[model samples]
Target: MLQTMIMTIVAIPLVLGMAAALGRSRLPAPAFALLLPLFAAVVSIGIEGMPAFPPVRAAHKFPYVLAAGGFVFALVAWRMRVVAPALAAIGAAIAIGLPAWWMGANILAGNSVKATTVAILAVLAIVGAFVAAARKAETPDGAHLLPQAIFATSLASALVAITGGYMGMAMFNGGLAALAGGYLLVSYVSHIRGNAQALALGGVGAFAFAWVAFMGLVATALLAPKASMAGLIAVGLTLPAAPLAAIVANRLTHFPAALRPLINGLIAAVPALAGILIAGLQFAG
Candidate 1:
C-alpha cells in the first residue's frame, strides 16, 4: 500500500508538469483536451501495466477503452461547436452505458422491459448532468467551473478506487487530479495577468472529456455488485457540486475574484471528502 501510494504521488507531478507544458504550448484548445486521456493512458499503463486489450476480454479492458472514448467524445463535441451539447449527450450515453453493458449490468443490458426503462432514465440523468456541467463551465461567469469539476471528479475517482480495491485505478485518478490541479494553478495565474481566455477556452474540451469519462467510471462502480454504494453516491454528489460551486461563487459579490477558484475548490472538496470517508470505512471493514 505504501508503494502504491508513493507511485501515485510521484506520477501526479510528472503528469502535471507535462500537461502544464502542453497547455503553455498554445495548441488549439480541443487538441490539447484530446491529448489529456492519452497522457492518462500512459500514466495508467506505466503504473498498472498495459490494460488488457482486444481479445483480452472487455471485462478487463473496458477501463482503458472507456477512458479513451470519453476523451475522444469530448474532442468530437468541441469540434461540433453549437451542436456540442447534443453530440456530447449522445457520446456520453454510449461511452458510459456501453461499459456497463460490457460489465453485464442489468441496468444496461436490457434484460427486461422495466430494467431497460430504468437504464435509459439513469443514462439520461447522467447525460443531463454531464451536459449541464459542461455548458455551465463554458459560460464566462463560470470560467473556473470546469477545472474545479475535473478536480472534484478526479479526487472522487481516487477515493472510489481505494475503497473498491483498485489500486491501479486509484493511481490513475491521482494522476488525473494532479493534472487538473496543475491546470487550475496555471489558469489562476493566467487569470491574474488577464490572459486566461485561451487556457479557459481550451479547457472546455478537457473539462467535457473529464466529465463524461468520470461519469463512465462512476457507472462502472455503480454496476459492480460488490462496489461500495456509499462511495458511488458520494461521487455522484460531486458531479453537480462543480456547477453549484460556480453558481454560488458567482453570487458572492463580496468575494474577491482572485479567490473564487479557492472557493470553488473548497466546495468541490466537500463531496470528495465524503467519498473518501465512506470508501475508507469499507476498506477498513
Candidate 2:
C-alpha cells in the first residue's frame, strides 16, 4: 500500500521532469531530470527504513555506483589529452578495479556470488559510459552523445527496476522505473528541436506508448506475484520490439538519406529478433 502510494506520488514528478529535460538544450535539463531519480531513491530509503545500505551488492544498487563511476571517469577524461594513453589506461584500470573492490566488499559482507557479479558489471557499465562520454567531450561533436547518454541511463533505470523487483525491493523498482521513463521521454523529445511540432508530438506520443507499455509490465512484476507471468510476456514482446520498431521507423522517415540500410538492418535485427525469440519460447512453454 505504501509502495503504491509512493509510486503514485513519484510518478508525477518523474513524468514532468522527463518532459522538461527532453525539451531543454542546456545541461540543466538533464541535471533536473537526474534529480527525480535521486528523489525517488531518497523516498525509497525512507520507506524501506533499512539501516545503512547493505554492503552494496552487484545487480542491486549498482547504478548509484555507475553514476559515481561516470563522474570519476569524466574527471579523468578531462585530463585525457595531456596524458592521453596514461589517462585512458588509468581510467580503464579504475573501471576494472572499482568493480573488483565492490565485489570484494560484497563478498566480505556475505552477498550472494551472483549478486556480487552483477554489482561489478553494473559498475563497469557505468564507468564505460563515463569514459566514453569523457573521450567524446574532447571532440568537436561531443555534445551529440548527450542523447545517447540519456537513452543509456533510462535503460539502466529500467534494468534496475526489474532487478530490484526480483530482489523484493518493490519500492525501489517502482520509483526507479517512474524516474527513468520520465527522463527518457523528456530527453528524447527535447533533442528533436526546431522540427515540426507535429512531428515532435508524434514522436513523443510513440515514446509514451512504448514507455507505458514497458513500465506497465514492470509495475505488474513488482506489484503482483501472479502478474510476473504477464510481465514476462510484455517484456519479451514489447521491450525490445517497441524500441527497435521506433528506431527503424525514425531512421526511415527522418534519416532516410543518412540511414545505412545494411548496417542499421543488422543493428536492429540481432536484438529485436532475439527478444522475439525469447518471448516466443516463454509463450511456448
Candidate 3:
C-alpha cells in the first residue's frame, strides 16, 4: 500500500512535473490538461502493469478507455472552437458506451438493461462535471480550482471503491487524484510566478482526457456487482463543489487572489469528505 501511494500520489512531482516540462518545451500546443495527466495516469497504471489488449474482462479495459478519452477530448477541443456540454455528453455516450458493451460482453450480456442505465447515468454525471469544470475561470478567483476539483472527484472515487471491495479501482482513482494534485501544485506555483502558462490551463483548455476517463471510470465501477453505486453518486456531489465554492468565494471581494484556488479546493473537499465518511459507514458493518 505504501508503494502504491508512492507510485500513484508521491510520484506526481517527478512524473507529472516532467510531463508538464515536456509539454511546455516540446509540444506545439503546450497544453497539459489532457496529455500531461493522461501521461501520469498511464504511468501510474504501471503499478498494476499494462492491461491486456482486447480485454476479455471488463476490468481490463480501463487503460484503453483512458487513452480513447484522451484522444477524443483532445481532438474535439482542437477541432471545435466551442463545444456544448450536451454534444460532449453525446460524444461521451458513444466513446464510453461502446467500450462498456464491448469489453463487458460476456458478463453484461444478460444485464444489458443494467448496463445501459448505468451508461446513461455515467454520461449525465460526466456532463455535470464538464459543465462545472467549464466554470473554472468564470470568476478568475482560482485558476487551479478546476484541477483541484478533479483531484477531489478522483480521491472521493477512491474512497467509494475502497468500500466497494475494489482495491484495484481504488488505486486507479488514487493515481488519478495524485496526478491532478500534481497539476494543482504546478498551477499554484505558476499562478504565483505570474507566468503565461498559469492562465492557459485556466478553464477546460486541455481537459480532453479527464471527462472521457471519468465516464469510463464511473460507468465501469458502477457496473461491478460489488461497487457502491449509491456512495459513488454521493461522491459525485463533489463535481459542482469547486465551481460553487468559487462563486461564493468570488462574492467575498476581500478573498486573497493567490489563495482563491486553495480556498475553492478546501471548500470542495467538504462534500468529498462527507462522501468518504458516508461510504465508510456503509461498510462499517
TM-score of each: 0.74, 0.44, 0.79
Question: How does each model score on lDDT?
Answer: 0.58, 0.38, 0.59
Which pairs clash in model 1? none
State how far residue 268 of model 2 sits from its true place (Å): 7.2
* lDDT tens digits by residue: candidate 1, 245-272: 6576567658676776677567756776
> Which candidate leads in TM-score?
3
Q: What does candidate 2's lDDT look like per residue over 26-82, in tens digits?
A: 433234323333444344444444333563444334435434443443343343323
Q: Report each candidate's C-alpha RMSD, comma-separated, in the order given.
A: 4.6, 9.6, 3.8
Better of 1 and 3 by TM-score: 3
The sequence of per-residue lDDT tens digits that candidate 3 reaches over residues 1-285 is 777568655584345744564354345442433575466447546656777777655556666766665665556556665556666556656765676666666655676555554655565555764664455235555434556666777778777777777777776677677666666666667767776345234324445534633553464365445555555655656654556665665666576657666676777677677767877887885
Worst 10 residues of 2 by lDDT: 198-207
Best by lDDT: 3
N/CA/C clash count, model 2: 8
Candidate 2 lands at a TM-score of: 0.44
lDDT of candidate 2 at residue 249, scale 0 to 100 = 42
Superposed by TM-score, candidate 2 places the C-alpha of residue 11 at a distance from the truth, in angstroms, of 0.9
Q: Which ranges of candidate 3 are over 4 A from the true structure?
A: 1-5, 12-14, 21-37, 105-120, 129-137, 195-206, 216-220, 223-225, 240-242
